[model samples]
Each structure stands twice: as C-alpha cells, then as structure tokens.
Target: MLKDINLNAMNYFEAVARLGGISKAAEELGVSPSAVSQQIRQFEQQFGVRLFKRDKRKLTLTLDGERLFQTTTQAFRMMRDVRSAIQRQRENRHFNLRVSPSFAVRWLSPRLKEFLDLAPNWAVRIDAAPDFSDFETEVVDLDLRYGEGGWTGLHEEAVVHDLVLPMCSPGYLEELRALSDDPIGQLRQARLIDSVKTHYRWDFWLARHGVMGERMVYPLRFDRSSMALQLAADGAGVVLESSTLALDQLESGALVPLSTAFEAIRFPAYWLVCPSRHTSRRIVRIFSDWMREAGRVHDARAAELITGLGCRIREQSGRQLPGEEYVGE
Candidate 1:
C-alpha cells in the first residue's frame, strides 16, 4: 500500500497540513494553490478518507489526518537526519554547537578556545540564540543547554549544578550597607536586578533564606543573564544569578556575594544535549568528554568561590518556584 502511494502528492499533503492553508503551503513549495489542493484531494481519494475539514476558511485536521501528519513529520525528520549524516561524512571535522546567548557569552565562549586548541584541525561553529535547537532539522551536532533536563528524543548529560545567589558590585554592596545595618532590611531598599528568563529569581532566593513579606524593588529587567550580571557589576543593582555564569565577575572582584549568612540555591543548571544518533560519533564523543572535564573544573572553582564568600549550598528540588519559567538561561 505504501509503495502504491504517490510520494509527491503525499509531500504536498504534508505541507498543506503543516502550514494549515493551501495558499501558504503553495507559496512555500513554489507551486500554485490549485496544485496543492489537487494533490491533497488526490491523496485523500487514494486513502479513501477525508484528511482535512474546513471551517470559516480555516483548515484543521481530521482524526486520520492527525495520525498521518505525525507519521509524515517523523518521516521528514528522519530524511533530514540522513541528509545531515551524509554531509557530516563528507566533512566530519565540522562541529556545530548551539547554546543560549547568555551561556555563550558568559560561560562557554570564554572556555571554547580550550576545545579548539585540543582539536586544532576541526571547524567549529557556535550558534547562540534564545530558542532551543530543533535537532531533527537543525545542523547542530550538540547543544550546551542551561535548563532542567528531560527533553524527549535527545540525550541530556548533566554538566554542572550551579549555586544561585544575590551578587552585586563592591561599591553597590557598600551603598547597600550604608542604607541599613539590617541585612534583610537593606535588601528591601536596594535596587533589584532580574534575569527575566532564568528559572531562579530573587524572590525564591530571598524566601529560601527566610526573608519574606518585604517589598523588593526591581528597577531593571533583562532577558539575558550576561546583561544582568554586567548591570550588577556596574553598580546598578543586586542580581540573583548562577555562579557559573558570573565566574569572571566574581573572580575579578567586579561582583561580590551579598551575604554569606544566606545559603545559595543549587540546581542542575547546565546540560550537554544531543540526538542519540550523533552521540556515538567520534567528534561528538570527543567534545562531550572535553565538556564534562571542563564542567568538573568549573564546578570546583564555583564551589570554592561560594565557599570563599562563606555561603552555604542548599539543593533546590524539581518543584516549580515563584517567577520560574522553563526557559533556556
């Protein structure tokens, strides 16, 4: 039955189903709307089932259509994987990695040279964006993602657990101290900076430290942690951020921990993710090993930094916290 089916018509049907309109699919496929409609019609007739139902000029899938769409989506994904594999065979030394902009700028980018130094002959590409990479269609061989693991169809290895706490410039800390002798009271009056996209937030950290029912002021909000860290480093406000991302600032004394009396929240923050098919590739394995070792070194340094500040580590559970969003970085 599969061999008897027209693959071209099926392709058009898949496109129309995916795009939800004949005109849109036609434009994408560089064909006429009439051509797309005809192909879908032929496909439905061949299967003896109505694949789509139109209501108020909007196209929606019927029950059978949904099943077919899922199958076709997976089929196309497999084809793309095959194409990528073929390309990789021709140029196996090319390494394409995707990561969040904050992670790229604040953490991975600075340490990436070590990987390059180890593999001098390889071509490396780092694509940093806010959205997660679609491994099925994207050319990324690996993704250095900062998030909770459990992404389907991918292998996620926990790279590191980072301590999240409030940090600010030494000058800002002095100003905060001048505001009030009371530590918790000082937080209420001092400006708060937020890394909007991160799951960890000022509220969660404060509440964990037994400080509650106090109004905190947030004068600045940034989607990227790098920007928030910079803002704190410039004495703008105190920022609640991961130690791993703020390593440079803390090490350089640009940012200081607010108080060691409060414990730092530790969560499984970073992961090295990739499709299972690419997991066994020589380049992938080599890079993954290097990343694991790098993460180990980073973990030690971050621990020492937190310890130096006289801060204690408290493990954060998988439960959702206030202001937590399931997003990258």
Candidate 2:
C-alpha cells in the first residue's frame, strides 16, 4: 500500500539522477530522452514538486529530488543484493538427506560415492535413523522410508520393492552344502540369525517350507535389520532380510543367498519421501531419478547373482525382481 509511489517513475528518476541527466539515462535505458522527460514530468505532476532544477547547460536535482534519490539508491542496492543472493543459492549444491538407519548402512552408504560423482560439486548431509525429523517444520530436504504409501500433507514416491530372503556367509553356505545335498532340508538345520526389526522371522520362513517353528534354531537376535545381516556376514547365522539391505555382503561374496524354496519376503516398498513443495525442486528430482536408476541396477545385479547361485525360483516367472519408477500419488 504505497500511495502515489510509481515504481516505473521511481526507476526513471533513479537512472536520470545516477547518470547525471535525462539524455544520458535515456541512452542507458534504450529509450528517447523525451520519454525519460515525460516519465519524470509525470512524477513531478503527481507529487506537485519539481524534481530537477534546470540551468543554462546542465540540470541539477532539487532538494526534494536529492532526498528521494538517496532512498531510491538504497532500494535498488537492496534489490541488487537480493538478486545476487538468489544467484548464489542457485549455484550451491549441498543437499540434506534423511534416511532409515538400516538403508543408510546397507545400501546408501556403499553407493553414495557413485551418486556424488554424478554431480561433482554436490555434497550430501545424511541423517540416519529408524525415523527422520518431521519434514513440515524441519530443514530435512529429502527422506527415504520403508512403508505403505497413503500419508497426507507430504509427497510420496515408491522407489523400489524390497525383496528379503535367507542369506549367510560363504563358509556357512559351504557347511550347509555338506550337511545335505538337499538345499531346503539343510537350511532347516543351519543356525538362524534373528532380526528383531522386521516381521520376516525364521519361523515364518521355515513354516513356508512345512517345517515347524520350533525346529528352526536361532542363537542370536539383533534389533536392527542391518545388524542382523552383519552378523550373518560374519558367519554367526543365516539372516532373513532385504537383499538390497545386505547388498555389500552379497556383492563381496561374504554372504550368499540361500535356496528360494522359501518365498522371498515382499512388503510395502521403499519410498522417496519429501515435502510437497520440494517435489518440484531440481535437486530433489535429480536425486530421485538417480536413485530409481540405482534401484534397477541393484535388482538386475541381484537377479544375476540369484540365477548364478541357482537360487532363482522358476515360479516367480519374471526376468528379475523388477524395479519401479516414482509416481506422485
């Protein structure tokens, strides 16, 4: 509500004052000198005050014009500062990512370097835990969640489906192979590593194979899925969890996927979660696309390994556990 404050007139006044005359300002503005004079005349008429004191050869600012010029210069200076700040922000590539603890250790930590290489100037700040800080009021830029979608006030994009199955150290696999040439039968006797985080337990997996829950032997339990998978990698026991979570161990031949006699565990997929406003952000979308491609690559690699190890169930009837692109729902 700035009464009688015409921005266009103010702009012309500032230019004429800074350039020292109407003709010079007109040249700078790419307009005729009469146009600049007309705009200034509109200003003086509206204000009922003279803005310039004309002499024989040169024009000088009136007392009123001098006071207005000070304010005009300061206003344009602030505008310049704001524009510079915005441009600097456009150049900055730091991103804040919040992730579940299990995914961070098992998946993102190992592969993050590759994504960083995609954008050399970009740096990421990761906050890992079971839950992330609230995105509504917090500064978290993006998040990953393992859940069924259908939340309000937030944007959700399902990135990848988590496939879980029994896996253990290579030496443990060797022992199981010795116990029986029959894969499913020997897995029943193999020591099981219990993960307290997920619902996929030794008993549930064993019952699918017609073995009673009590028949499966488990000597240790870990509260986090990553910890349980780590124990399995260390050859403590067999772990039933996300292959994507145990990616490093599986890739390094530390842990081997067991026979697919028990169906691979599937639940709601992992989602790329963000505030709705951030959904359109270039960096956020770039990261989302990068991760989706990463998920497909992991699925293809897992499929290749599963086929190589003779663990792929023909009943699954797909080339691989397929990856998915995000849809805003």
Candidate 3:
C-alpha cells in the first residue's frame, strides 16, 4: 500500500522543489498557487515527513525533503526512460492511416514532418480516401475523417473542429481596393471558387455577414481544397476555406481575411476514428496522442490570429457585434 501511494502528491512536491516555489510550480503545472501549496502539505502528511522549510519570505527544502527529492527525482527519471523505451519499441510497429484527399493535402501533409520527427521509426501507409476500405476487413489503424459524428461502431477523437471564412491573397485584396469603390461588395464581384465535396458555399458566408445577394459567381470549381487555395493565392478568386487550411498562408501574409462573417459549423471534427476493439496496439496510442497535441497547438495559434485580426477590424470599422466575434472553432 505504501508503494501504491499517490504519485500526484509526489509530482506536486517534485514540481515545487524543482521550481523553488509553489507559485512558480503552479504556473508550470497550470494550476493555482494555493492548490500547489495544499498538495505539498497533503504529501507531507501522507509521508509523515516535512518536505520544505517555510521561512517568513521563502521556501527551502529541509534535509529530509532533499533526500526524498533526490530519490523521487531519480525514480521519476527512470519511469520516464521506461516510457520512452516502450514508445521507441512501438514506433517501429506498422500501421495504416486513412484520410480524405483534401485533408491529406491541405492539413496533414504540411505537418507530417513534425509527426515524423516525433515517431521517426514508425511505418505509416496513408490511404487518401475514406471510400473503398473497410475498417473491419482492412488493416488500417486509424481513419482521419471530416463529417458529422455519425460514424457508428468506432471510437472517435476530434482532432479539430473548424469554421468557414473567406480568405484572399494580399495581391487580390490590393487589386480589389484599386479596382472599385466598394471593396467588400466588389470583392464578391470576382470569381468564386468552390469545393465540390463540402457544399458550404459563399452564400453561407455572405448570409452570415448580412450581405444577401446573388451568389452565381463560381467560375472555378475544384475537388480538392489545396487547388482552390492555390488559385486564391494566385489572385484567381476568393475562397471560403477552413481556418485550419488557411492558417499557414494567413500567418505568412499569403492570405487575408475578407470579413468577420465566419460561422462555426459543427461538422464532424477531423477525428482520429479507429475501430473500437483493436485500439490496444501501442502504435495507435502514440499516434493518437501526437495527433491530439498537434491539433491543440494548431487551434490555439489559429485562435490567436483570429482574435488579433478581429480586434483590429472592429476598431477600424467602429462597430461591435453581439455573440463571440468569429474565431476558428
């Protein structure tokens, strides 16, 4: 039972001691200082040992605390090494991934390098279409999907929930400004590009922006989002692309937002869809963790960009809207 004692308390103590203060430990762990202090107290009580000497203005480890910290630190390091060893073994394991072509091209392909860096030895076979493969019959370890969460008999972890927004290249924006008085309205006068699979169109965006008019302006249509984005970048037209797809371009100033009429469509998030029973494979777990973390980082960056731009736009327009001003979902 003593060997089975709470590791969380041990973690709290180690963090506090390593960081030299409860407040700093809290910041590192994303918790409150009070929480860290309480955990340290509870840990001391559980072990019948004083882990820290609290002076009027500072916290320092006592002799016993130092000893315990040294031992626990080594123990934790060993545990982490063991975990890494296991993950290294798992990385060499074979797995298959199924994903849509557009998702593969726009989102996953760009970030494959990061994933490869994390799991260097892993063998990944990517099938870039959801059709023609049966998860039960096929040997696929995971499926990345875009849809409503209606797929039955599978465990789905949402990688990203996205929203639609109009994105144009900087050159296209410059041209629109130079060509017409009503840049926003004249912006819509140019050719519109469409994604064939996902039917969410410019009308959906325009209606959300309270600018209702004829939307018969699609001169170019593509089955893949990557192509449409390329056309937009070349100043062919404006596209209603997902914030996730436009994220890299938007950051590099290759693309700019047309308006703040983004809508949070509740599509089935980019999910790591896996058959429920066979997910015990070690490789699957590692990839799933990697995908989730990557998704979180991407979403955070997209939100930061959207919020920054949204504030600037609001200040420039001198108008405020109800509800959360458009950010990526």
Best TM-score goes to which candidate? 1
Estimate every model's Cα lDDT from 0 to 1.
Answer: 0.85, 0.75, 0.72
Q: Candidate 2's residue-wise lDDT over 1-329, tens digit each?
A: 57658888888999999989888999998999999999999988878999899897587999999999999999998998999998787678688888877877767888898888776766678888676458768788898876555556788887766667888888888888888877776777788788765645566566666765455777887778878887888887788887777766777888887665555654445778887889788778878989999887877776676666656433322222134222211
Task: Write the residue-wise lDDT of candidate 1 on 1-329 in tens digits.
Answer: 68999999989988888888999999999999999989999999999999999887789999999999999978987998999998887676788988888888878878888998888878889888877888878898988888878787789999877888889999999998998878787788788998888877776667666766647757799998888999999999889988888988898999998887667888788888888988987788888999889889988888888888889988876845543446668
Query: Candidate 3: worst 10 consecutive residues by lDDT?
Result: 311-320
Looking at model 2, residue 170 earns an lDDT score of 83
TM-score-superior candidate, 1 or 2: 1
State every prediction's TM-score relative to the real structure: 0.69, 0.66, 0.61
lDDT of 3 by residue, 1-329 (tens): 86867789899888888878888889988999889888888999987988899998599999999999998888888998999999987765777888877778778898888877776777878888746347768888888876545456888877775655677887877777676657457555667787655535565555656765575467798767778888898888888777677777888878787655443332325777777875787778877888888888877777678666662212111112322122111
Better of 2 and 3 by TM-score: 2
Ranking by TM-score: 1, 2, 3
Q: Sort every candidate by lDDT, greatest first.
A: 1, 2, 3
Best by lDDT: 1
Clashing pairs in 1: none
* Candidate 1 worst ten-residue window by lDDT: 319-328
| Candidate 3 C-alpha error for residue 196, in Å | 1.7
Q: Could you tell me the lDDT of residue 234 within candidate 3? A: 82
